[model samples]
Target: MRPHRCWRPAAGGWLGRRLLRPPGALPEPFFLGLCLRCGQCAQACPRSAIRIARWEHGLSTGTPYIAARETACDLCGGQAPACAAVCPTQALHLEPGEPVRMGTAVIDATRCLAHMGDICRSCFNACPLRGRAIVLEGALRPVVDPALCTGCGLCEEHCLVEPAAIHVEPLNP
Candidate 1:
């Protein structure tokens, strides 16, 4: 007989607003199915960006995720993304040369320093993809390009505001 699967709660409630999956992770359904829930991806993360969900997160418990506001994905710098590389089940599969899509960064102009008439280019300057993923508009306002952004959360990580002016909206969230 097959062993019983330990099912956690789904990504709902508070988790839905905060969960950010590791770079190159498969879509929600596919990832949940293929992931071994063995904590390998979290262990392989060099920046310690990946974390397993807790029991409070329900069905997503033990699932790997990221909280970009706290720490962001660095793309592993000069190597294949570690989380994907270590996922034995390919739940975090990454196609060669394809850009990862963690989510899209949304700017809250009401809270952004630049949009509020200050000279803050922190978000644009911090972007790994720079001019491509995030660009400077007139008056140094930062704009996120959905087509080019991987939603790696560098912008959110670098934002100086008490609450980040720019934050990623996870695909499943």
Candidate 2:
């Protein structure tokens, strides 16, 4: 039998697996085994950020995940995360007030307008958590605060640059 290949960003491989999982997702191994693939999570998402894993995902097929660049999780406004609330299996268990660390945003300095000495604050302004999750450094350069970031990907979705100057790197843990 072939061994499973978990996605790793540094390797620049597994491009398709770079998708971000919904908030409160279990670790990948457990999530793959426990998720019922009922697509309830996808249906519950107001932003339509969560999607069922496709056939190309191999063993992970039918699980819910997010592609932040396309659509980002909005945490469902004032309510609990909708996707997790609708999950039949406990695969997406999230306690109330629990923080989600979906992934971290990394800015590519070469492509970032603010980092290049431009005055772009799109990323900073678009962040739902604003000053807490993303802060402006020198020259209004947006810097992600990993400790507070929920990896909701709103910043990535709002980035004006082609190919996006800042992107979320999925956290497998």
Candidate 3:
């Protein structure tokens, strides 16, 4: 008897374990255990901020999720959110404030096309959270509600064109 190259079992335990994995590149917990590795988050993103976690986090590799290096959560509105809507799993949970229960969305008015008066609202429209999270300030400026904004970087990832109008930053305790 012999085993075929294509037909082989996993090298290690498939269940119960801490699974010491690699450090997440994305500022947010995009690679949280709850993630199903589906690229929907990336595909739906207008700004293309969402990307797959290509590196090996413990034993899993190619799992669909964003790495800290590639992007982070914008924490949309603090109420409604975009990524959460697309995410099949509750992996990308909800929270309030700049920490976004997970992360925070920061406004880089200088880089933001909306602030530049170029006309872009990918973030505004895509945001699942609202009211306190992200506020539509003036014509194009979007004010982040620190008390209600989660750091879920969705806004940053959905900005039209190049440099995202908004960016995600780890919530400062």
Highest-scoring model, lDDT: 1
Instruction: Give the best candidate by TM-score.
Output: 1
**Range of the 10 consecutive residues with the lowest summed lDDT in candidate 1:** 6-15
> What's the ranking of the predictions by lDDT, best on top?
1, 2, 3
Tell me the whole-model lDDT of each prediction, alpha carbons only. Answer: 0.83, 0.82, 0.51
C-alpha lDDT of candidate 3 relative to the true structure: 0.51
TM-score of 1: 0.89
Error of 3 at 126 (Å): 1.2
What's each prediction's TM-score? 0.89, 0.88, 0.45
After TM-score superposition, the amount by which residue 100's alpha carbon in candidate 1 deviates from its true location, in angstroms, is 1.0
Q: Mind giving the per-residue lDDT tens digits that candidate 1 earns over 103-172?
A: 9999999999998989999999889999888988874899988988888888999999979999998875
